[model samples]
Target: MRLNLRTIWKMIRELSGDDAYERYLKNFHKLHAHDEQHECDTPLSKAEFFKQWQDEKWQGIKRCC
Candidate 1:
């Protein structure tokens, strides 16, 4: 592994959930690139994906005890 600026930036994005949409798109394509069983063939937009992701994250209860 190299310690370059790009590598460092990617690491930071991974740790900070910044590249989550990219990762999601990759996985979605890998899993559904050929499947045609769903109504919506395309993945969610960037804004939609993040909005849903945040909603799922904070919709429930969280405790700090």
Candidate 2:
């Protein structure tokens, strides 16, 4: 699917509610933890990298809202 930032953000807000953004932040932290545990030195683990990317992007939207 082709999802722009605005569309993704709106979907998250609608489906997960305002707290959904918080969940993303939490997932970011979790991904950070996973990265650390594996000594990945990246923002996320291979399995979670995409999710982390999306979450971080959504987080920016949450901050603005």
Candidate 3:
């Protein structure tokens, strides 16, 4: 699946309705900051970043039928 900024923002908006989303965003920002630090200073690959975010944000959320 391909993800662009629009898709990401859509997901963020949807997830933001949850209380835990704030915590997830905080952790994600921390991870982004740490990634920005350090000597390597390499940016996260799109897939890697999205995978990490999905795990952090939606791992336990279940969809209702």
Candidate 4:
């Protein structure tokens, strides 16, 4: 990994989907229409959601090897 600015930006963009919340909201609304899913008026705020989302991705034992 180069320490250049472009490299850093690319890494950030990849790890953090540019519009994750928007996508989440779309799915939220779609799923909300279903009677089986729980009722909710909102999704987690950006900071908290992103923190948990990223942490969850790396927390478990990965089987990629």
Candidate 5:
């Protein structure tokens, strides 16, 4: 397979969880930008996005089996 620098960088960010907020914002705009009710609403700030991400990640059941 052929992978360029941009693809490599994107893979690194994805593996490191560094682009979660950016992806969220992109999806938000793509899906909500034209919706009247949501047009005025804003995507979460970076801090808020990370906080929520962490909460959802760790606040679930923990099992070893």
Candidate 6:
């Protein structure tokens, strides 16, 4: 058997919503990175982002069939 890392990463990103976080980070930096006094490169680290993501996810309807 061969391990398909690309496919595995895609599935993990979809399930964990990491791809969204990455997109958010990209947009955040693009809009805010110009500030010379910016205190941080990222508004939220992976841990904080994941916690908030989970909270928002379960706080309301996630999906419906």
**Highest lDDT model number:** 1
Compute each candidate's TM-score over C-alphas. Answer: 0.68, 0.29, 0.32, 0.52, 0.70, 0.51
The superposed Cα distance between candidate 4 and the true structure at residue 21, in angstroms, equals: 1.6
Question: lDDT by residue for model 1 over 19-49, one digit each (tens)?
Answer: 9999999999888867678555688999999
Give per-residue CA lDDT, model 3, range 1-65, as digits (tens): 45688788777776664334455556656777756545544455556665676677676757887
* lDDT by residue (tens digit), candidate 4, 1-65: 45698788866875678666667778877888775567676777888877877788788786776
Pull out the clashing pairs in model 5.
Answer: none
How far is 60's C-alpha from truth in model 4 (Å)?
3.7
Clashes of each: 0, 0, 0, 0, 0, 0
Model 6 lDDT, full chain set: 0.79
Clashing pairs in 6: none
TM-score ranking, high to low: 5, 1, 4, 6, 3, 2
Number of the top TM-score candidate: 5
RMSD of 3: 9.6
lDDT of each: 0.86, 0.59, 0.61, 0.74, 0.84, 0.79
Each candidate's root-mean-square deviation in Å? 2.9, 11.0, 9.6, 7.1, 2.9, 4.2
**What is the Å distance of residue 65 in model 1 from its true position?**
6.0
Give lDDT tens digits, candidate 2, residues 1-65: 45688788887776755545456557767777755546544334444654655566675445543
lDDT of 2 at 54: 59
By lDDT, highest first, what's the ranking?
1, 5, 6, 4, 3, 2
Please say which candidate is ahead in lDDT: 4 or 5. Answer: 5
